[model samples]
Target: MLDWSKATKYSGILQLYRNLIELRRNKQKNTRGLMGQNIRVFHTNDQTKVIAYHRWMEGGPGDDVIVVANFSTQSFDSYTIGFPNSGTWELRFNSDWKGYCEDFTNKGYSTTAHEGECDGLPCQGNVGLGPYSLIILSQ
Candidate 1:
């Protein structure tokens, strides 16, 4: 067990959880999709231990959110993932960011969707992913 007395409020894991909670509950950020009922699981690769899904309200621009996770032990410099629309997607959160933890390998960035057919989606984007990490992107 962990010692609660030694747990500081400034700990990386604590901050990470706070950030995620704020992201999910803050309505002013236009992230209602995280609270919405619409969801689509678009990609799942057992070999690579990766899975991706989309969450949206009405879908488009500020109302859409895409989540991708890597469960493997290896990292990828460039992994193609599908997007619902063709445009710039902002990197809202990255689980592997060094600020979240000292041992994390900071990877993942905002990417623009390009013209292509991938994972049954109309647009595709290449993103860097760290091992056992997840990234959240939004428009």
Candidate 2:
């Protein structure tokens, strides 16, 4: 059998767990979705090994959340992604943050969204994506 107490002392898993719990608790807007709202896989780029999607209650703005993920080993400095609206979107969580794990490359991530169009959406933004990482952005 594994010694659970000894394992917790050596791992930062608890911190990550706490962060996730806090996020879940604070994101009231996402509650609708959490309670069987909706999920849409908005974009996918096989060449870049990237995928993006939105989760929301009625699929408008405020409650809307976007999630981007990179599956490739290569990082993208300014990878473009579609936005549901033309407005500011804040980076809520980044899986590559060094706080989660020391070996991760703490890439300078962008916290603001830019206006444009991609993937059939009215707005777009560029983001610094770390290899094999996931990021959540919200208004």
Clashes of each: 0, 0
Name the lDDT value of residue 77 in candidate 2: 78
Q: What's the CA error at residue 48 for candidate 1, in Å?
A: 0.4
lDDT of 2 by residue, 19-102 (tens): 556555545453233233577887999998999987776655556778789999988778888887766776767777788788
Residues 1-139 of candidate 1 have per-residue lDDT tens digits of: 8666645844888777777887687445756678778999999999999999999888777778999999999998889989988989888888899998888899889899988988999999988899999988888
**Pairs in clash, predicted candidate 1:** none
Model 1 weakest lDDT span, ten residues long: 23-32
> What is the Cα-based lDDT of residue 12 in candidate 1?
84
Candidate 1 residue-pair clash tally: 0
lDDT of 2 at 111: 55
Candidate number with greatest TM-score: 1
Candidate 2 local distance difference test against the native: 0.72
Local error of candidate 2 at residue 103 (angstroms): 0.7
